[model samples]
Target: MEELTLTTPALLFSAISLIMLAYTNRFLAYAAIIRNLSDKYLKHQDASVLRQIKNLRLRIQLTRYMQIAGISSLLFCVLTMFLIYIHYPIVAVWAFGLGLVLLILSLLFLIWEIQISAKSLQHHLGDIENHFKK
Candidate 1:
């Protein structure tokens, strides 16, 4: 295995920062959608709207997990840098490895959320098609 260096962990700083930015954007979008959905559900009290609200709730939970994992990844990266600074090369390597694992987990959660979102959109489209057919 290669020696762990401060630069190695520093490299992830920008990548992680960008990922966090993307995650924040997703979260904000979800919030807006939730508010709009809530208003619609209150006005109509439709079963379809209720279903959408439930789906959004699940997606929001997943997004929260993604953000947690991403933030943990960034924390580990910082820890790795600190360990390297303190001359703990072995622990630094482990810290860096853990950070990478957390990043991978975050990406996996993102994929799951995207799949759910796509399925929800497809269902909405199907509803529109059915209405037109009737």
Candidate 2:
């Protein structure tokens, strides 16, 4: 295999930083939505709103997992760079590989969350349709 230099891990820095930024933004959006939902639930306690809250709760948890995996990926990449700096090329390669795996896991979580989000939207749409039908 080719040499695992510091530059190899350094290359991931920009990509990981952007991903972390996106994940943070997602978390912030969820927080805002949760707060809004909480207020609505407090005021009315409607079954529909409660269902939405439950959906949001699951989405928020998945978002947290995504953030954790993404952060761990960044941490591993940093570790890889450190290992390279200390002249452990083999170990650096392994660390970098682990980082990649974590990143992939994060993306998988994101996909799952998105699927759930779409389903939730569809449920809302179904409610609207039922109201119109009535």
Candidate 3:
């Protein structure tokens, strides 16, 4: 196999940074929506509102996993670079591969979270649908 260069791992730094930024933004947005829903639930104690809270809780948990995976990818990528610097090419390759796998896992979680998010919005849309039906 070819030698692992420091630049190869460094290339991932920007991509991971951007992904982390996006994940953080998603978490912040979800937090705001959850707070609003919780306040509404407290005031009225509606079943639908409660359901939304449950969904949000799941989404929040998924986001946490997504964040952890993304961070793990970055950690491994950094380790890959460190190994390369220490002149360990074979191990560096393994670390780099693990980092890529972690990145793929993070993406999968994001996709699942987004699917759940779309379904969550459907609850709100159901009201509009009911109105039109009547």
Stretches off by above 4 angstroms in model 2 are none
Q: Which candidate would rank higher by TM-score, 1 or 3?
A: 1
Alpha carbon lDDT of each predicted model: 0.93, 0.90, 0.92
Best by TM-score: 1
Which stretch of 10 consecutive residues in model 1 shows the poorest summed lDDT? 1-10
Candidate 1 per-residue lDDT over residues 1-134, each given as its tens digit: 67887899899999989998998999999899999989998899899988988998999999999999999999999999999999999889999999999999999999999999999999999999999999
Q: Give each model a TM-score.
A: 0.97, 0.95, 0.94
Give per-model CA RMSD.
0.8, 1.0, 1.2
Q: For candidate 2, what is the lDDT?
A: 0.90
- For residues 6-40, what per-residue lDDT tens digits would candidate 2 score against the true structure? 88778888988998898889889989988998998
Task: lDDT for model 1, please.
Answer: 0.93
Summarize candidate 3's per-residue lDDT along 62-120 as a digit string, tens digits: 99999999999999999999998888899999999999999999999999999999987
Shift in Å, residue 130, candidate 3: 0.9
